[model samples]
Target: EAATATATAAAGDDGGGAWRVVGGDASADGGESPTRGDASRLSRAVDVWSLGCVLYGVLDADEHPYGSWFEREVNVINGKRNLDRIKHLPEAHALITALIEEAPTARPSAVEALEHPFFWPDARRLQFIQEVSDRLDKITVDNPMLDSLEGRSSAVFGHRGWQVVLKPSLLEDAGKHRYYRPHSVRDLLRLIRNKRHHYRELAKPLQLELGDNAGAFYRYFAHPSRFPGLLMAVYAFATEYLAHEPLFAGYLGPETARRYAADAKERCASAGASEEDMLAAEEAARAAALLSGDTLQETRREWFPREDAWGDAARFSVSSAAAAREAAGALGSAAGLPPVGGPAGAAAA
Candidate 1:
C-alpha cells in the first residue's frame, strides 16, 4: 500500500509536467497548462486547485461542472463565479475556489484549514456537523455510485478507452468484429453495475477533514500503517490503562463506554475472574512499574501508533509476561518476554 501510494503521488506529479515548468503563454491558443502566462510561479497554487478538482472528480466520478471545454476555460479565467458554470454545487463552491485560487497567498495554511468556512460556517454549524456526520455515516455504498451512472455506458467507455490482450480468443474470432473486442451491451451493463457496487463498498464509514488544505480520511488510509494502525494503538492503550468506565467515555463516548464496560464485566464473570482480582491486577502492575528502576512504562509507550505525534510522553504499567505479549501483539508486534518465566515475568511481577 505504501509503495502504491508513493507511485500514485509520483504519477500525479509527473502527469502534470507543464505545471512544474516556469513559463509559457497562458493567453496563447490551447496551452494545457494553467500557469502558462503571467503569474506562472503561482503554479503551485494551481496544484492546490487541481487537488480540489481531483477530490471532486473522485467524489462525483470525474464530471466537470462546466458544460464544455471552452466553458471550463472561461470559468477558470473568471475565477469560476458564473452560476451557470457551477449550477450544481452541493456546498460552498467559493471554498473550492479559495483553495484553488491562482494567487498563492490567498490559500489557507494547513492548520487553519480545519476552521475553514467550507468545513462548517460557525461553532454552532460545526456542532451541527455531527448531524452531517451521522447522515454521511448513513450514506451507503450504493447512493453515490447509483446516482453517477446515468445510462452513459457507451460514452464512458469511449471517454476512458478500453484495452484487450492478444489471446487465443482473438485469433479464433479473427476477421470478425469480435476480433476487436468491443464490449457487448450486456457486458457494459454488468461493468457499470459492478463498478457502482465496488465504489459503494469502498466509500462507507469514511470521514473527511481539512488540514493545510483539505483531504479525506481515506486518503491517509491509502498509506501503510499511517493512520489506522495509530488509531488501533491508541485504542489499545485506552483499554490497558484507564478504568473501563472513564476510559470508554473519554475515548469513545459515554454511552459507548458504558455499554463496553458492561460487556467487559460480563466477560470477566464468564472467565471466573472477580472484579476484585481485576482491580488487584491493575494496582499491582502500577506499583511495580513505579518502584522499579527500569522505565518499563516507557517501553510500553513505544507501542502507541502515533506516540511521536503526542506532545507529552505517557506510560503503561508493566503487566504479566502473557499480558505484555498480548499488548505487544495487539499493537502489531511480536511478544518478547514470557508472562511467567522469572522475576521479570508478568505473573503479577
Candidate 2:
C-alpha cells in the first residue's frame, strides 16, 4: 500500500483546483503481486483506464457514459460494462480494455497501448493526431478592440480608416520563463494606420446595414465591454464556420460570415442601410480587428485561440462534436479524431 499511500497523499485535498496531473496510481488492490517494473506497468494500465474514462467525460463535457464514476467502476469490475457508449470511443477502447485486464500479468503495457491501432488510427487520424500533438507551434489570437477616437481620430485616420493594438501584458504566458515584449500604443496605432486601407473594405457593408447595432460591435472590440451579446454572436458564428480559413483567424468574423449569411442579407434589405454603410461597418470591424491588440493577445492565448467578444481563448476549446464533424465535412477531413459531438444539430447553422 506504499504506492497507494503516496498517491493518496499526492492527490491532496479532493477539492478541485486549477492544476491537476492526471496519472496512474500504484498500491491499489492491497499491493499484491509483481516486481517494481511489473507493478509500474500495471499501475500505468490502471491510469490508462482512468484516462479513458476521463477522456470520455471531457469528450462528453463531464457526462459519464455509465452514469457516474463509482457506478461505472463497479459495473466495469463486475464485467457488466462496455466502452462503446462513448460517442466516438474509437477502436482504442479494445486496446485499453486489454491493458486494464483484471490479472496484472494479462494487462498490456503502456508501450503496447501506445502502439495500438486505436492510438495510431489510419493515415488521416495519424496526420491529425500528429498535428495536434505538434500544435505547440500553432498560434491562435483573440482580442478586444479599444475605444475608437470617435470622430476625432476619425479625422486623423479617416471616416472608415482606423488602427488598433493590444497591451503587451496579455501576451505573457505563466507557463513560460521568458517574457514577451509588450506592444506600445504608438506601435499599435501605427500598425492600424498602415493596415487601415485593407480593413475599411471589410467594414463598409456592416456600417451601412445594421447602423446602430453595428456601433456596439466596434465599441465592444475597442474595450472590453460588460455587454457583449451581439459581439459574441458574431464571434461564435465566425469561429465555427471560418476558424480554418487562413485570412480570418485573428480577424473577427465578417458580418457576412454568419452561418446564415442570407439572414444578414435579409436584415440589410429590411433595414435599408445603403450597401456603402454596411460595407463601412463590416470593413471597420475587420480592419480594426486585423490591427487589434487582442488579436495578438489571443494569438498567444491558445492553440486555436480566437478572440470572442467575451475575451476568452482556448486551444482544443470544447465544441459540439457534431459541429466539428460538420466543420470536417466542410473542410474535407476531421482535424483530428471526430471531436466528441454535442447534441444532434449541434453544429448546424
Candidate 3:
C-alpha cells in the first residue's frame, strides 16, 4: 500500500488556498511527491493537467487557464477553465479543455494528445472530410453518428440552408450532380456523396476540370468557422472506429494501422491464440483493408494539388457564370452533348 500525504499552501486574505494532491509522500515545505505505485496510477493524468496549464500559458501570453493563483485550484476543481484568450484558436482551445478535464479517465493519453487535430497537417484535415463523407454514405438515417454530425453541423452551419455559406458557382456545380437544394447538413452530405460518385464516373478530362476546383468545393466545409468542429467530429468517429475495428484501421494510415495491429496482437496472445494463427489473422486483416481501398487518400490526391492550396484564398475565386460555363462545357464534351453557349444550349436556355 502507498502512503497518502497532503500539502497545504498559505491561505489568501479571503481564507482560501490551492488544492493538494491526495496520494504522495510528505515534504518539509508542504509539497508532496507520489510514491511508486501512486505515481504509476496518477502521474499520467497529473502530467496531462500540468501540460494543459503550460500550453495555456504559452498560447495565451502567460495567462493561466484557471483564474488567478488564489482561485486557480478552486476553479480547476469546479471545472471552470478560463479559455477566453485561446478561443480564437479553436483546435488548441479544445485540446487544452480535454487535457485539463477534472476526471482523470477523461483526459487523453500522451499518444492521443499528439494525434489531436491541432497537430494535423492540411492534407490530413482534407482526408478527414473524405472519410466522414464515405462513412456518411453507408449509415442509415437513424444512426447515432448522424446525430453527432447533425449536432456539430447545426452548431456551425445552423438549421437553415447551407447555400448561404456556399458560393453560387459551387451550388451550380452541385446542381449538375442533381443536388439542387442543400438545406441542411444531411443535405450537404448527400450532395457530397453524389458529387464524389459523379466525379469517379467522369472522364479524365472532366475529372481534371472539376478537380481543379476542388479547393473551392472544400471551402464550404473547411471555412474557418466550421473546420474545428469538422476536425473534432472526424477525430471522435475515428477513435470509436479504431477501438471497435482495429483490424481495418489501415484506412486511417499506415502508422495507425501498425499501432492498432500491435494491440490486436496482444489481444490474440491474451486469448491464447497460437503465434502462427495470429500472424495469419494479421495478414488477412491487412489484405481486407487493402482490398477495400482508402477512399480518403485517393480523394485527397485527386482533389488537392498541394496542402498550401487549402489556405491560399479566403473565397473561391471563379465567377458563377464562368465556372458554370466551364463545368458545363467539360461535362458536355465528355458526354457528347452540345457545349455551353452553342445553338443547342441556347435553345434549351
Candidate 4:
C-alpha cells in the first residue's frame, strides 16, 4: 500500500486531488490568517510545500508568505517564488526555495527538511542585524520640521491619485482598491527613528525648559539594545504616532517653539491628534516648526503602496491573483519578488 501511494503521488493529474491554497490579499487583511494550503491531496512534496508556506507565514510577520493563494500557485506553476521578500533571512529563503521547487523530485522530503541547516539559529546573522540597526541609529539630521520628505501620501495627503491610506481592518465590503506589502520590523524601527526626527517637531517645544535632560530621549529611538521607555509609548499609542505626522505637515511653525506648539495643537486637534505626543509638551510644541529649512522626513519616492486610482472591482478579489497572473503576469511580478533559485542545499533542489 505504501509503495503504491509513493508511486502514484508524483504523476497526479494537473490538479487531481492536488491541494489548492485559498485566501485574500494579506498585506492589509486584518482577521484570521487569510491563507492556507488545503490538504486535499496526499503528495509528500505537497506536504513539504505546505510546510514551507506555513514557515513563510511565521517569519514574514503578518504578511502572507507568498502573497495570496493564487499568487503562490502561479509561482509554483512557473518555478518561481516571492523569495526576495525573504531574502533578508538567507536561511529561510534557501529552505523555502528548495521546498517549493517546481519538480516534485527536486523537493526535500519531510525528514530531510526538518534537518536543514536553515533551522539552526545563526548568532552571526543576529549580530549583523544588530550592527546594522546600531549604525542606522547614530544617523542624525537638522530641522526635520523644515524638511520636505516625499512619501506615499497618507490619508491626509488628500485622496489624490493612489494615496497610501492606513486603516485598521479590511472588511469584505471595505473598498480595498489598493496594493499593499507588510512592513518589516526593521521598517517599523526606521519609522520610529523617523518619528524621532520628523514627529519630534511636535516634541520640540518643551525640550528646553522641561529639564537639562529634556531632549535626552531624542536619539535613543530604536537601537536594538538600550531601547528607551519612549519606544513603549510609540508602540502602545501607535495611533497617535500615525496621526501626528500627517497633521503636522499642514502646520507651518513660523513663530517661537511655544507658539508653534500651540498653533500645531489647535490644528492637529482638528486633524484627530490624541494630544499625547508633542502637542502635550510646551517646549516641544514651541519648537515644532521654527525651521525655515527643509521640513522633516522628506523623500523623493513613496515607500508604501498607493491606492489604485482606477479602483477596479476585480483588483480586490481573492481570485484576482490568478486572474492578474493569467492576464499580464502582473500580481507576483508586480510584487517585486526575487527570481527563483536563491540560496543552496535543499533536500533536493
Best TM-score goes to which candidate? 3
- Candidate 2 structure lDDT: 0.34
lDDT, candidate 3, 171-279, per-residue tens: 6667765644444455665665566556666556545544645554454366665443555655554544332343235344454444455554454334333234334
Off by over 4 Å in 3: 1-35, 180-183, 186-220, 225-228, 240-243, 246-349
Could you give me the TM-score of model 4 versus the true structure?
Answer: 0.25
Which digits, one per residue and each the tens of the lDDT, describe model 2 over residues 28-85?
Answer: 3332344678546545655655554455545555554344544643445343435555
Q: In model 3, which range of ten residues has the least summed lDDT? A: 1-10
TM-score of each: 0.22, 0.24, 0.55, 0.25
Candidate 3 all-Cα RMSD: 16.9
Q: lDDT (CA) for every model shown?
A: 0.35, 0.34, 0.51, 0.34
Ranking by lDDT: 3, 1, 4, 2
Ranking by TM-score: 3, 4, 2, 1
Where model 2 places Cα greater than 4 Å from the true spot, the runs are: 1-38, 87-89, 121-349
At residue 322, candidate 1 shows an lDDT of 44
Residues 10-64 of candidate 1 have per-residue lDDT tens digits of 2223443433221222322233544344344344445555555554444455364
Over 4 Å off in model 4, which ranges? 1-42, 121-349
